[model samples]
Target: MALSVVMPLDISGESAKYPALFEKMGVDFTARRCTTPEEVVVLARDADAIITEGSQCPIPREVIENLNRCRIIAGTQIGYDTFDILAAAERGILVTNVPGYCVEEVSDHAMALILACARQVVALNEAAKRGEWGFGPHSSHIREVIRARMDALGGKTLGILGFGAIGRSLAPKARAFRMRVLASDPFVDAPVGQEAGVEMVDWPTLLRESDFISIHAALTPETRHVFDENAFASLKPTCCLVNT
Candidate 1:
């Protein structure tokens, strides 16, 4: 019998990459369109292995009960808090994910967001297009933009919400800018956080102290919507939040 493989990404031989990869691996596989969390269970119920980019669909202990043939689940991207690994391990299901799969692209995107925020890219571009230069006699139009920053990244604290691969990846870059990094990850040991030159702190302490906070956390039941109203309200008013 062929090994049954189910991928949660919508696939087509014409443009999709997986078909060719499976053919190369000499494995039997199927891909389905699963955009919603609800659609996951109905389609993944019988899958021997699930290769997915999205993981919101909870793979609870019950799903393990239902999946006898399933041996492994491979997440296409970095985070897989959607998969209950502890439960899966109890049931002997191997879970894997591609780490920092698109490192350059992701870092580039984050840096771009930070720079755009610093350079007033949106406002200046819009003004330039309309033939509007500095309205004030001496760089006055940019005064409002100046208010947004009031301070640059240097000498500012950058609190990284998670000390996983992505957070560690950004640390040196943030440090290079002469910014202090404070990291909070329940799973991270004090030694590791210290090795990164980031002081280990509680979530509330990190949020309150940071001038620029970047979220690099994996979404878990505990972490989903973790940055809700109360969390945001706790941040310093001058702080900026960046999500990736």
Candidate 2:
């Protein structure tokens, strides 16, 4: 008998490729758009393996306890915060995630957001649509537009909240634009930061000094709401933030 693989999430349209890919690998794959823990428990109880997008379909302790024959719980995304790793381990099931899947793509998006914010691209585009060219003394918001600063990326500081793979990828991209990169990660050491060509700094220093800040940290008990009121208050008035 072929091994059974179950995906307890809605895998449609573009995601339909997964079924075909699994077929080529000779696994008996089933994609069920499960919306509840009960649904997952029913569908994956006797499966050999389970694959899911961790963020969308949470596999809590209760669900893990019901996966009788599952040998592995594979999260197709980088973060697997939705799964109960301890519960899976207790049941002899391995929990795995794809950390390198979107490193470059996510870093590129962060850079795009940083540039767009620095130049006020969206605001300018809206103004242009409203027939405001932001010049020649005829525009109503000329003062605001002129005071937008819209400074170049050269010589500005960029602080990254995490020095993980995505953050490491972003450092070189920021350097290419002549920006100084700083990073803050309680788990990362100074030597690791040095190797990545970023200055290791505390959160306070990063908040105070960076002209642009990009958050690349995984959501956890410690990092949840890390940029609260106090953090925002510490930032430079002109600082731009990008969270991805």
Candidate 3:
């Protein structure tokens, strides 16, 4: 009998490609649009392997304990936080995830947002749409545009909350615009920050010093609500924050 594989997520438009791919690998593949732990238990109980699609389709401890034959659980996304790793370990089932997924794309998007905020791009675009052409000094809307006051990125400070892969990738990009970069992460050392041309600082220092702050931290208990009311109050009045 061929080994069975089950995917417990609604893969949407990518449904057609999975069966052919699995068949070529000599495995019996089944895709279920499972959105709950009960659904996962029913669909993957007897499978040899399971594939998941990040936190959206959680495979909790209950589901892991119910699996009678599953030997591996592979996550298609970068984070496997939703998986019951301890339960899988007890059952001798390997848990894995794609760590390099979207590193560049996420950093690029963060940079785009930083630029937009510095230039007041959205506000200016909205003003233009309202027939407020404020380019010329004599235009009636010139005063409004002057009040918009776009700041230059050069000589500004950018603080990165998590100095992991995506944060490292964003450092040089910010440097190209002549922005000073600071980073804070317990896992990353000062040498790594120096190598990336960024200052290694504490979280409070990063919050107080940055003109623009970007968050690249993983979603976990410790990282959640990091920017609470106190943190918000610490930021400069003109500071811009981006998370993408």
- lDDT (tens digit, per residue) of candidate 1 on 149-221: 6446787788888888878878878888888899999999989988988888999999889888888887878
* Model 2 error, position 51 (Å): 0.8
Output the number of the TM-score-best candidate: 2
- Positional deviation of 199 in candidate 2, in angstroms? 0.6
TM-scores, one per candidate: 0.77, 0.90, 0.89
Of candidates 2 and 1, the better by lDDT? 2
**Model 1 score (lDDT):** 0.75
Q: How many clashes in each structure?
A: 0, 0, 0
TM-score of 1: 0.77
Best-to-worst lDDT order: 2, 3, 1
Better of 2 and 3 by TM-score: 2
Lowest-scoring 10 consecutive residues by lDDT in candidate 2?
Answer: 138-147
Clash count in backbone of candidate 3 = 0
C-alpha lDDT of all candidate models, in order: 0.75, 0.90, 0.89
Q: Give the alpha carbon lDDT tens digit for every residue of 2-68 in model 3.
A: 9999998665665568889999999999987887789989999999999888667888899999999
Kindly indicate the candidate among 1 and 3 with the higher TM-score.
3
